[model samples]
Target: MKAARSDRGSQTRKLLLFTAERLFAEYGVEGVSNRQVSEAAGQSNNFAVGYHVGSKEDLVVAIVRRHAESIERRSAEMVARLPAVPALRDWVSCLVRPAVEHLASLGVPSWYARFIAQAMTHPTYRKLVFDEAFASRSFRHCHEGMFRLVPQLPEEVRRERDDMGRLMLVHMCAERERALQEGTASPRSTWESTATGLVDALVGLWLAPVTGPR
Candidate 1:
C-alpha cells in the first residue's frame, strides 16, 4: 500500500511539472499563473499550486530544470555514440549536436535556452532554477565528456572553446526569438549552423588557419 501511494504521488508531481512547463513555454513567464498551471495540469483544486509547488519562481525553476535534464540526457546519449578517441572536431559536435537535433525534432524553440540565460542572470531570480532543478552531477559529467573529447587542447583553450560554445548557444537562443517574431522557420535556423561545421570553424579559428568564420 505504501509503495502504491508513493508511485501515485510521483505520478502526480510529474503531471504537474509537465503541465507547468508547457504553460510557461507557450505563455511568457510573467504571464502564467499558478492556478492556471494547476488547471492546465487537470487538478481540480485551485490551491494545488500552493500546496504542491512552493512559489511561482519555484514553478519556473522546476520547468527550467526539467528542460536542462532532458538536454543533458540527450547530450550524453549522443556523446556515447562518438568514436572512442574523438578529435577536436568530434569533441565539438559531441558537445553540441545532441541539442540541435533533439530540440529540433521536438519542435522546441531555442527560446527556451534564452529563457535559461535570462533565468540564470536575472537579478531577482537568477540561480533559483539552475541550482535546484539541474543536478550538479550532470554538469560534472558534461565537463568530463568535454575533457575526454578535447584531449589535445590546453585547459585554457578548452575553457575558451567552452565559452565559444556558450556564445553560440546564446546566439542561437536570441536569434530564435527573432525568428519566431519574423515567422522565419527552417530546418536549420541559420545557414552553416551545424554542430560539426561549427566545431570545424572554431578549431580553425583557434589554430589560426583562418579557413572559416570567426
Candidate 2:
C-alpha cells in the first residue's frame, strides 16, 4: 500500500511539472499562480503545487532539474569526445549540441525550451535559472574550453557577448520549438542543423572584431 501510494504521488508530481511547464511557457511565469498550476493539473487540492513542489520558485527549479540530468549527461559525453586540442567550433559544439540534442530527444510539443526561455528572462527567476544551468561541471568545462580559444576582450565586451550568446541560444531554441509545435516553418529542417547553425553563429559572435573603444 505504501509503495502504491508513493508511485501515485510521484506520478502526480510529474503531471504537475508538465502542466506547469506548458502553462508557464504560454503564460509568463509570473502570470501563472501555484493554485492555477495545481488546478490545471486536475488536482482537487489547489495547494498541490505547494505540497508537491513548494513555492513558485521551487516549481521552476523542479522543472529545470527534471531536464538537467539528461542535458548534463549529454554534455559530459560530448566533452569526453573532444580532441586533445579542441578548436573553436569543437568547443562550441560541446556547448550547443547537448541542449539541442536533449530538446530533440523530447520529440514534438516539448515545452522545456520555451519554459527555460521564460525562466531566463523572468526578473525574479533569472538568477536562479542561470545558477542552476551553469552549476553543472560539464557546462563549466565547455565554457572554459570555449573561451580559451576566443580572443581576449575587455571585460565589458566579454560580458556583453556572453549575454548575447545566451539570448541567441535560448530564444532560438524556444522559437524553433514553438514553430515545430505550431506546424510553422523553421529555418533549419532538423535540430541537428539548428545546433550547427548556432555553433557557427556563436563562433562568429565570440570571434568578431571588437571595433568599439578599448
Candidate 3:
C-alpha cells in the first residue's frame, strides 16, 4: 500500500514539474510563482513545497538537472564525432553546437536559455552555475582545450572563454525573442541565418589573438 502510494505521488509530482518546466520556458521564471505553478499544474494543496520536491527552488533545480543532462548527453555524442586530436576551436564548437541545435527543438520552451542565463546572475538561483556544468568534466574539458589552443590567454580571459558558449546561447535567445516581438521587430523566421551568425561570433571570440595589451 505504501510503495504504491509513493509511486503514485511521485508520478503526480513529476507531472507538476513538467507542467512548471513548460510554463517557465514560455513565461519568464521570475514572472511565475508557486501558486501559479500549482494552479497551472492542477495539483491540490501545497504539494510542490518541501512535500515532494522541496521548494520552487528545488523544482527549478530539478528542471535544470533534466535539461542540463540532455545537453551533456548531446555534447558527448558531438564530441565523439571530433577528430582524434581535437583542437581548441573543435572542442569549443562541440560544446556549443549541441545547445544551439537543441534550442531549435520544439521541446524547449521559449526563452529558456535566456532565463537560464539570467539565473547565472540571480542571487537566489546562482547555484545553477554548478548544476549547469561548472563542476562537470565535459565543461572542464573545453576549458582545458581553450588553454591548449590559445596558450597565451590569461586566467581572466580563459574564464571568459569558458563561459562564451552559454553567453552565445543567451544572446541567441534574446535576439530571437526580440525579433519575435511586434511593431518594431521584423519577422525574422530566419533562424538558420541567426544560428550561423552565432557560430561566427563564437569562432571570432575564441580565435582572436588574446596576447595584446588588456
Candidate 4:
C-alpha cells in the first residue's frame, strides 16, 4: 500500500510539473499562480504545488532540474569527444547541440524551450533560472573552452556579447519550438540544422571585430 501510494504521488508530481511548464510557457511565470497550476494539473487540492514543490520559485527550479540531467549528460559526452586544440565552433557546438538535441528528443509540442525562454526573460526569475540551468560542470567546461578561443575584449564587450549570445540561443529555440507546434515554417528543416545555424552565428558574434572604444 505504501509503495502504491508513493508511485501515485510520483506520478502526480510529474503531471503537475508538465502542466505547470506548459502553462508557464504560455503565460509568464508571474501571470500564473500556484493554485492555478494545481487546478490546471487536475489536483483536487489547490495547494498541490506547495505540497509537492514548495513555493513558486521552487516549482520553477524543479522544472529546470527535471531536464538538466539529460542536457548535462549530452554536454559531457560532447566535451569528451572534443579533439585537442578544438576550434571555437567545436566548443560552441558543445553548448548548443545538447540543448537542441534534448528538445528534439522530447518530440513536438514540447514546452521546455519556451518555458526556459520565459523564465530567462522574467525579471525576477532570470538569474534563478540561468544559474540553475548552467550550473553543470560540463557547461562550465564548455564555457571556459569556448572563451579560450575568443579574442580578448574589454570586460564590458565580453559581458554584452555573452548576454546577446544567451538571448539568441534561448529565444531562437523557443521560437522554433513555437513554430513547430503551430505548424508554421521554420528556417531550418531540422533541429540539427538549427544547431548548425546557431553555432555559426555564435562563432561570428564572439569573433566579430570590436569597433567601439576598447
Candidate 5:
C-alpha cells in the first residue's frame, strides 16, 4: 500500500540521518563523503544519500532542522513565561536551557552536541548551520529579550560577546557529551547542573565590562 511505502521511505531517511550524524561527528564534515554515509548506513545504493538528502550541505541543514524544532518549541515556552521586564539571567536561561534540555531528553551518548560543535568548526558549514538556527522565530525572540536587558554595548563589544557566548555554550555541551559517552566523570552531576553553571558563566560574559581597543 502507499502508506507502507511511505513508512519504509521514512525509515530509510531516518537511518541515513542517524548514520550521517555519527560519521560526521566522528569524522569532520569535510572528512566524510556522501557515498560513505550511504554505505555506512547499510544502503545497497551508494547514491542513497544523494537521492534522499541531496548535497552534504543539505544533509547538515536537515539534521539541524530535525533538532531545531524541539529546541525552538522549548524556547517559545520559556519566552511565554517571561515577565514584562525580564532579568538578563532569565533571557540567558531561555537560550541555554532549551539546548541542554533537549540533550538531556536524548538520554546518554547522544551525538548531536559534538556533531554541532564539529559543524561550527568548518568555515562554510559554520555559517550555514548557525544561519539555520538564527532563522528560528523562537531563537530570535529569546535574543531580542536578552539584548534588551543588557547594558548598552558598542557594536564591536556586542559582536565579541556574542562569539564568546556561542563558543562557551557549544564547547561546554560538547565536553559534557564526550564525558558522558566515555563514562568519565563530569564536573556537574547532571545536565541540569551543567546548564545552571553555563547560564552563570554566560551572564558574567554578557554583563562583563568592556574596554575600547587601543
Candidate 6:
C-alpha cells in the first residue's frame, strides 16, 4: 500500500511539473498561480503544487532542473569528445549543441524553449534559471574551454560578449521553436543546422575587436 501511494505521489509531481511548464510558456510565470497549475494538472486539491513543489520559485526550479538534467548529460558527452586543444568553434558547439539536441529530441509542440524565454524575461526568475544553468559542471567546463581560446580579451569585453552570446542562443531557439509550432519559415531546417549558425555567429562575436567605451 505504501509503495502504491508513493508511486501515485511521484506521478502527481511529474504531472504538475509538465502542466506548469506549458502554462508558464503560454502565460508568463508571474501570470500563473500555483493554484492554476495544480488545477490544470487535474488535481482536486488546488494546493497540490504547494504540497509537492513548494512555492512558485520552487516550481520554476523543478521544471528547469528536469530539462537541465538531460541537457547536462548531453553536454558531458560532448565535452568528453573535445579535441586535445579544442578550437573556439569546438567549444562553442559543445555549449550550443546539447541544448539544440535536447530541444530537437522533444519533437514538435515542445514548450521548454518558450518557457525558458519567458522565465528569463522575468526579473527574479531570470537569475534563478541562470544560476541553475551555471551550476552544471559540464556547462562550466565548456565555458572554461571557450574562455581559454580568448584570454587576450579584456574582462569587461569578455563579460559583455558572454551576455550577448547567451541571449542570442536563448532567443534564437525560442524563435525557432515558435516558428515550428506556427508553421512559419525557420532559418534552418534542422536543429543541427541552427546550432551551426549559432556557433558561427558566436565565434565572430567573441573574436570581434573590442572598442573602448565612449
RMSD of each: 5.8, 1.2, 3.8, 1.3, 1.3, 1.4
Ranking by TM-score: 2, 4, 5, 6, 3, 1
Q: Please give the distance, in angstroms, between residue 122's alpha carbon in candidate 5 and its true position after superposition.
A: 1.8
Off by over 4 Å in 3: 1-11, 22-31, 107-111, 161-165, 177-195, 209-214
Per-residue lDDT for 43 in model 4? 97
Give candidate 2 misplaced runs (Cα > 4 Å).
Answer: none
Q: State the lDDT at 195 in candidate 1.
A: 53
Q: Say which prediction, candidate 2 or candidate 6, comes out ahead on TM-score.
A: 2
Candidate 3, residues 6-88, lDDT tens digits: the string is 99888977877777766765575677777778778777765564466777788788777766776677777877788988876
State the lDDT of candidate 2 residue by residue for 1-214, as single tens digits: 9999999999999999999999999997998999999999999999999998899999988889889889999999989898999998998899899999999999999998899888877787987788787678999988998889899999999999999999999999999999999999999999999999999999999999989557
Clashes of each: 0, 0, 1, 0, 0, 0
Better of 3 and 6 by lDDT: 6
lDDT of 6: 0.92
Candidate 1 vs candidate 5: which has greater TM-score?
A: 5
lDDT of 4 by residue, 127-195 (tens): 778788887899988999889999999999999999999999999999999999999999999999999
Prediction 2 global C-alpha lDDT: 0.92
* Model 2 residue 10 distance off true place after TM-score fit, in angstroms: 0.4
Instruction: Report the Cα lDDT for residue 208, model 1.
Output: 44
Candidate 5: C-alpha RMSD to true structure equals 1.3
Task: Say which prediction, candidate 1 or candidate 2, comes out ahead on lDDT.
Answer: 2
Q: Write the per-residue lDDT of candidate 1 for residues 99-133, one digit (tens) a residue.
A: 55555554534345545555555555555754643
Model 5 Cα lDDT, one tens digit per residue, 3-111: 9998988899999998888888889789999999999999999999998888999999988888999999998898899888889999999999999999999887798
Better-scoring candidate (lDDT), 1 or 3: 3
Worst 10 residues of 6 by lDDT: 149-158
Report how far residue 26 has shifted in candidate 2, in Å.
0.5
